[model samples]
Target chain A: MAHDTIIAALKAKFAELVTTEFRDNFRVVVAPARLFDVLQSLKDEHGFNMLFELTAADYLKYPKATDRFGVVYGLLNMATGVRIFVKTWLNEPDLTLPSAFPLWKGADWLEREVYDMYGILFDGHPDLRRILMPEAFTSFPLRKDYPLRGRGERHNFAVITRAES
Target chain B: MPLEALPTLPEGPEKDYLWTLNFGPQHPATHTTLRLILTLDGETVVTAVPDIGFLHSGFEKLGEDLDFNQYVTIVDRMNYISPIMNEIAWHHTVEKLMGIELTPRCKYIRTILGELARISDHLLCAGAQALDLGAFTAFLYGFQQREVIYDIYETISGQRFHPSYTRVGGLLFDVTDQFIRKVRNFVKEFPKTHADMCRLLNRNRIFLERTQGIGVLSKELAIDLSCTGPLARSSGVVRDLRKDEPYLAYPDFQTAFKVVCAAEGDCYARYIVRMEEMIESLKIIDAAIENLPAGAVNVDVESKAVFPAQTSVYRSIESMIQHFELVMPNRQWTPPVDEVYGAIESPNGELGFYIVSDGTGVAYRARTRPPSYIHFAVFPYLIEGHQISDVVAVLGSLNIIAAELDR
Candidate 1:
């Protein structure tokens, strides 16, 4: 089957669930609330059995950005080799999305990573502890609000002094 | 306080008991500072808790600060051993998101270089695995070939480990015929060296006894944990990103290779899979070189997708402004604000780039789905019933590099 036909079938199947469609590359952006069910349906009915990736986005510079944070999921069909992108937008104040760990076991670490960097909460994740950062890390460094140099020269000097002591 | 006078409780029978031991966070066999606190019943392991994050560098956060062009260097640092593959995977992903297709020549060059990286990675893993199993001679032999491959990499990228050779739109520069000739020579000689290494370890009774049925991961467990690259392939999983989803010159090349798997799904299977993969990678490099195309290495200067050259910026004020705006740390180059998850078959399984572009010059979120991280998650499970000595052997066979895992 052609890539376009597969996408067309998906659009037809989940037309009601999706808010916007980026048809050129088979990406469908659904509302955050409906993302979990949509993903479950895609996996059970549509055969996108492999949850390839689950990552987050910080949209600090977009004009039509309804929410400042967006979470993206990539699913793949092992048999057919077709990839589908599912996206859901999250409001800046509370960056939380429904967890997909129950559906795909691989989402365990991926969700933890999203939580670690973007400070997004994966509701219902069994062990959603920080995967890549120190336990005492105070801030989500991936957030746009966090400066690259971090609290500036004073923080660096303080850290150096503390280390020496 | 004499023990004989103080307490004399009558004992009917003395029992021989097993003791538990913890290895790692500093053990040489854990490979990459992974702390595996193990509860051992004497030599056999009862339970293992793999505590990671000893090498986390917060690569995801670093991506937010660096521009699209500079971010390739960051990805290059993820899997330091196979830096070229990481950089190329990220490059292809960014190019896909921006909808900029490179010239055929660039695609061929990437294919060749990626194959070379695969060979180097497999050699390192194979050698390291042998070393962990007490086959020191095999390790030296593997490193001998790896050193030659590194020299080839240095000639192309000018960096020993982290080359950052792959650019967002294309390669850093074009490869000369001399480099191609050297690669061809390496291809011809690599098979004999590989055969010698295999003879040194493959059928050795000691190596087989140590690895054959150790750390067995069934096909179902492998799939559940989402193991990629050699780990998944060894368990009879037919999922190669290059073969399944062709991105660069992989589709153009015509090559035949088997996905090596063992029904046993043990540490031995993983070792065989990697050793066989090195041979297959050599085949791919040969095919890519034979069918190498001739054209401009990068897209034209007028292409709006890639950042324009400095000469174009100097000649045209509009170009200068666009370049400056695109490269600015604060101002991001918008590229449709969509998200793309591009994966390539790296030497260590599926190295995927889950890029969330908010239509900005800087990636909103660049998440690397490294295979090593997933393999590490299942490490404790694999080592549960194994002995303390076999823990090092099992960990070495998994080939978990801390940089990629913690990144």
Candidate 2:
């Protein structure tokens, strides 16, 4: 009941900028620039208080579309107990999107993680450093283009052994 | 009070104004490779920054190479404390992506095993919390009960830890009467030792003094940080996935269990919530066992989603061919081109899997939203104003498992 209302509201508010799908729950595809506005409205107006999850998917070789990357945000309306997904598409060359930290505090680390794994820059993130990967590591291992066995980074670690101390 | 508003003390004789202290990349209180950089003025902590990622094994990258069932072994290593919960959550995500609903018998069995995992997880947390606070007796009592749970796990899955017993459509094997009896016996005999352990630490004056107001996470901050499981509930968040978004057999036994909450939002409150949750898990386990469903545990064999039974594979040529077809990649089953998120109310918190299937045998993306990662993120915020001595108390209450955190 509440999900339909929220879905309808999201569709109405983001009219041309967003398209909606309902699989197990509402899934909205929004333009990358308009993601901040759409998510702001969802948080302020639609009562989706918690930004439960944020993840990225690489569709580089999939038969889907022109976009190579998709960033997903799982929003939950605690009052309604319904989860809705907001996704924004990004392609190569310049993959940057607005951060959701201003809307939810949980987005702070989630955005950092997205930046870490997918190398997608967030415009206004306070501290957009790598959260999971080491600081000296250059490659984003989660990217589809990245090899699973890695490019010798794992084996390149310098052995630091105690000698005569 | 705001962090900036905290009173700054002047430098004293033969002492610096402020200095950095590293708690660990290896320390007893950390229990794992969690390095906390703390700025200390005398004994008071000015700021604390947690540096993680010492255990990142590139599990998500590995998931891209392995198919759904093969990835189960990897998930088992993520939340190694209660590995079975990870198995259930991983397969639950894959099944959701593939649009498969498990049988009633399978759901009930999964629910029972899940609660057993929760009991073991909470018992370990409670025990370790007390041990960190210098009460060794409580830890021993708690591990004794955990061993009982491990016995039940061994009976069902042939292993104590990292069982990898759950399958996409069902479990690896049906619940034997021996497994049921072992579980029943564990549930029947655990409460007395649990009560004794609780009495040993719950009301102890030293514990209360050390933890009552130390590292308090306010309700607003808890929700903002996406803290779940007992951590959020202890802060009076009143949100539990098992209750709010019922999965497995949680819906059937909805009224049989209680979601415990404590408004204190301190180490003591988290201890109370975890202690009560173990009792609640026992109740759910009792109800599930009493009303255990009958019929086949695995889904229809004709579906070919899982391996054919061993007897059938040995008897019939057709069954052997079916097994080979299922195992071989050339004739591997194709999943749909869609994405689905499956989450379960794990012992520590909400463990979710966001799976993307691009009409392939392997998942295009398998993202695990480990609760430990999110819960640990809020740690530096919670520990800023606490004394140096209270650091272990706060860290223990948070239950930051490095395997889950790094994965």
Candidate with the greatest TM-score versus the true structure: 2
Q: Which stretches of model 2 miss by more than 4 angstroms?
A: A20-22, A159-165, B1-16
Q: What share of the true interface contacts does each candidate keep?
A: 0.47, 0.59
Error of 2 at B242 (Å): 1.3
TM-score of 2: 0.95
**Per-prediction TM-score to the true structure, in the order listed:** 0.88, 0.95
| CA deviation > 4 Å runs, candidate 1 | A1-16, A19-25, A31-33, A60-62, A92-98, A152-165, B1-21, B305-334
> Considering summed lDDT, which 10 consecutive residues are worst modelled in model 1 chain B?
B1-10
Model 1 RMSD in Å is: 6.1
Put down candidate 2 lDDT per residue, B58-158, tens digits, no spaces: 89988988888889999999988898999999998888777777899999999999999998999889888999999999989989988888888888888
- Model 1 Cα lDDT, one tens digit per residue, B1-407: 11221222333454234443556678767776787666666678777766677888778778866777798888888888888999888888888788888899899888888988888888888888889889898888888888888888888878877888877677777888877888988998899889999999989999999999998888777776777778877877877777777779888654645556566778999899888888877877888888788887878756655567668888999888767766676664567776666778888888887776766787777778888888888787788878888988889888899989998
Scored by lDDT, the top model is: 2
Q: After superposition, how far is residue B285 of candidate 1 from its true place, in Å?
A: 1.0
